[model samples]
Target: MAGDASPAVAALSEAELLSRIFPRLAVDATHSAATLLGPGDDAAIISAPDARTVISIDTQVQDQDFRLAWPNGYRSTGFDVGWKAAAQNLSDINAMGARATSMVVSLTLPPDTPVTWVEDLADGLTAGIRGLGADGCSVAGGDLGRGREISVTVAVLGTLDGGPPVLRSGAQPGDVLALAGTAGQAAAGLALLESGVPMEQLDDGLRNLTERQRRPVPPLQAGPAARKAGATAMLDVSDGLLRDGRRMALASHVAMDLDPDRLGPLAAGVEPAARLLGRNAMEWVLSGGEDHGLLATFPPDIQLPPGFTAIGSIQALGIDEGPRVTIAGRAADTGGWDHFAD
Candidate 1:
């Protein structure tokens, strides 16, 4: 605590820290219409207009999920963690074809943590909720505690707006597989953050990659749009494409064959990083995750929803075999983020 920015959060009483955090999390009552009551209460009351609420939760841990300082000399900021917390949780609700309405975030800080960093995290959470186009969502309430490492957990609630929630098991053979956001850029960005290259030496495009790693932009609008367009099944590409695609295939009881030509643009986005890092861009696109893009399947007759482009098609499962994701009629490698594997 001597050299640290501020004596870890331990020095400040929980009430004292709450006093500092509340102001940063205040929301406009006009915009946060769905939240009947927010923070300062035992639990928040949210208005679920559709009478059904969709819920999801996700967690990020220090070092395991993110690093304070990277090999490239870049330091992870509180804002980065806060934004990512919002992104990943919101992405879960999005995958269900629902619009997020409220979120409760829990934070665990180490003894040496800086007060300024916590404030920045609060600011980042507010910014992510607004900047990421979740206009209807608001921070309801959360918990804080002392822990060995920084940890963040977010539980979010969403509304289907009276529509049926899209499920992964709804996909059928002959459905058109589509994607609604950039792929591989974030994995490329992660590579840049962990690279030995000096930050100053990176060009704007290269730096952009790192930005994605720090703050991913999940396509919030695409979810409802796909649902409106009758998307049969969907999920967020949080894990690598192959990994998540394999999941969708299994859930839908179908096989998926991605068109390499359709994936070219996604791969191209990471070429600069791939070349610099001596890695394969296509691999990044195929196996990379964390962009929070939507992966959905739509019926063959209708036009894909806005912000979506067809990348593949659903097919019947192979003879006596399970569902799998393939490229050019061959099973693709399922390599992506695996917490247990790591």
Candidate 2:
């Protein structure tokens, strides 16, 4: 492989690269308590205190999901990619109402990719895991490979801590719909990035929005809290609220009725950007994707978990009306992120 030294990764043997990068992952001292055994073995051992494991995987590819270059595209840093990658998978585990325990990441990179970039990526991943306040979660192990483009795949493992896993099919009529974190920020940031607005020209708020697009911070704690509070159904809003809400409604055989008044606060954060782009902030709030916030339904009489705000309600699906989601008494646009759609 060293003979094909045209790319940086090829300049050194795989062993050499691993030797240089593992230390940067920081899996040593601040490791998760749930990690019984971490990297350097054939396989890792993680604790499943609940005797059941929750797992989820996600992948990010170069150009398709992000770009390392400028204002014309996603000026994402290695840290941003690592952070977003971890957040995406962690959100999935959270949606199941489990606590993240460990992760195994696989990386496919071009030979020319720098070693420092990989190191920074590891740091970002560590930061993301720790940021969740799950001191028991860690990156157990991973694999590295050579490819034409950069791609990151992470498989996360979590434990329900003896609680039943939350599912989208559990909502029932009269359940209150709630949300635990901000929405529209990621989509608004994406719009700003695609608008050709130079980073230097951006104010602090716009800059923050761009950062959100680069590295989203999902409310990881809300998932388990909602479950503990007896949530009937739940999911992570990786897609737009309307789209995902429709999914939950269909699964639960119910109708989701969103109150625009309840969504106003969520839309306010993006109003400035929406005005600058001549787009509606509410549209972003309802249809934007990648926020990864927890969306849940609970019995109306149950007190909502901390950080969760009531935003909608679940109703029985009428005989004439199939399972659907609505906002302000009207059907909402189902448009959202579709990898295969033109």
Candidate 3:
């Protein structure tokens, strides 16, 4: 009986591996209102209570999107990968001012992968959904297959609760720009992950930053709250604040002028980690991605939501000037995650 539980996925039949995974994927929800039919079928049937469905999909590839082990000798656990998979997709739904209903995941795994790692990933998926306050969401179904490296793809379904979606193009010139959740923490964590410092030597704060990179805490509730508070434009800050701000500016055809006072606190939060590496914390705040924080624009007349803080204001674009993000009317230092960039 001890010998039967092989360490590697290669030793197990596909059916056997799935049997180990399915049970771990179950969320604790007594009844998922969205999922009329979940798993064990040709497709999942999720209810669209608002007469419309907000859907989003994302993919993560090993070695490119993430690594099994970093230079610091910190191994990326299956739980980390699974948690991130749920986070990135769920954040997208939240950005649209909708609540996640269900998700379907697909995994591509190398033959040498460990069975326990896959099981941990299943547990992580459920944990992320429940831990991130999306307890009502359901894991409807998913697929698994062989591949050269590990890859995970998740498609999420959401409903708007009879409200209109806040979009990137809706920001007016006078709108106030705001942020929900911390900035630069995940990027600072990524720096720590890739640094020469070994995992054991890291202090508690530094270690916590590393965990942020692994399991991002997206501000799921803040999204709907911002929408209710009359958010004009919004998106998850998965691609650094400057880059994403530029995107919002371009879409709305306005300039976004950041207030240094608002950004200073965020920079200070990660200053210790940045100092250890001889880097600037403010740069991370500008270009750091994967924090999954929401960047939103709201009308000046309304009260800002509970989790949101004013970070900037929207301005009219100057003649012949393209959409740009600036701090105190000056150009911002620009660098963000660009997958194909040299």
Candidate 4:
């Protein structure tokens, strides 16, 4: 039988833990809603009288989403873990065109975890919320449990604020396709860091890629802005561009066509990163995930908001036809991220 031989764990009081751990982490202040019986409570409750709430939750597994120990043996900071959890949850809220209000996190960690790690993770979570303009959201409540592998689950709540929630099914034929926020930067960043290529050796474009992967800059405001601009349909580019565009097409019963020239600028940005990795930049731009750009369709003559650029168009198609996503008039074999792909 295996025996448990570990250091004599100093069981610090929660207050001691907070004091020792908090300074190393980011701070996110919450408005009154997140304060109704906060940190010391068994649970947290917030006011939600907006008559409608948009909720989203996500779970990340250690090696699946990210490695605890990278090729350089760089262990991710507690802040990194917390930041990612909050960002993923908040991204979903942004996708629904809502303002994030509050959040709760549940954590499972090894018994050997340091108290500082927990505190820093909390700080990161708050920082992520703040970064997305979730002024009213806080860490609120969470669970601490033991496990062999690290896993985090976060639940977020948001208010629509009298704005209509945009759906994936409202696009119409001849509607113009537009994108808000840049694309392919995150994928390029991951490639540069993973390949042991130093940042100094790369050009400014490639360096931007490194920044994209380390900290995602999601367009939280873009979703609501699109809805307000009378967008026919919308979705955040959580998956790759092709996959997400195809989703809108299927839901709206339209065929989607993207002009490669319109995406040329973004394509140019990923080239250096691709050349360094011996891959095609267009592949990364078309299929990379985690960029979180907003993809929307609108009437051709409608005026778009700042941060948005036209990319393509929606077309009427046969009812029995599969949703078509074409790139520069050609059918693309790989549309985007698929969990089961070999």
lDDT values for all models = 0.91, 0.87, 0.91, 0.75
Instruction: Give per-residue CA lDDT, model 4, range 117-208, as digits (tens).
Output: 67667777767777766777766666656687778899888887888888889989999999988788877777776776655676777766
Query: Which number leads on TM-score?
Result: 1
Global local distance difference test of model 1: 0.91
The superposed Cα distance between candidate 1 and the true structure at residue 226, in angstroms, equals 0.5
Instruction: Put down candidate 2 lDDT per residue, 134-154, tens digits, no spaces.
Output: 557888899999999899999
Clashes of each: 0, 0, 0, 0
Cα RMSD for candidates in order? 1.2, 2.7, 2.2, 3.9
Give candidate 3's error at residue 228 in angstroms: 1.0
Clashes of 2: 0
Error of 1 at 127 (Å): 0.7
lDDT assessment of candidate 3: 0.91
lDDT of 3 by residue, 34-64 (tens): 7888888889999998799999999999988
Of 1 and 4, the candidate ranking higher by lDDT: 1
In order of lDDT, best first, we have 3, 1, 2, 4
TM-score of 3: 0.97
Ranking by TM-score: 1, 3, 2, 4
Model 1 ranges with Cα > 4 A deviation: none
Instruction: Kindly list the per-residue Cα lDDT of model 1 for residues 1-342, writing each as its tens digit.
Output: 357656567779999998888898887875488999888889999999988999999999999778988999988999999999999999999999999999999999987788888988998888888888887898999999889889999999999999999998889999999999889999999999998997899999999999998999999999999999999999999988899999999899999999999999988889989999999999999888899999999989999989999999999876897999999888798999888885
Candidate 3: residue pairs that collide:
none
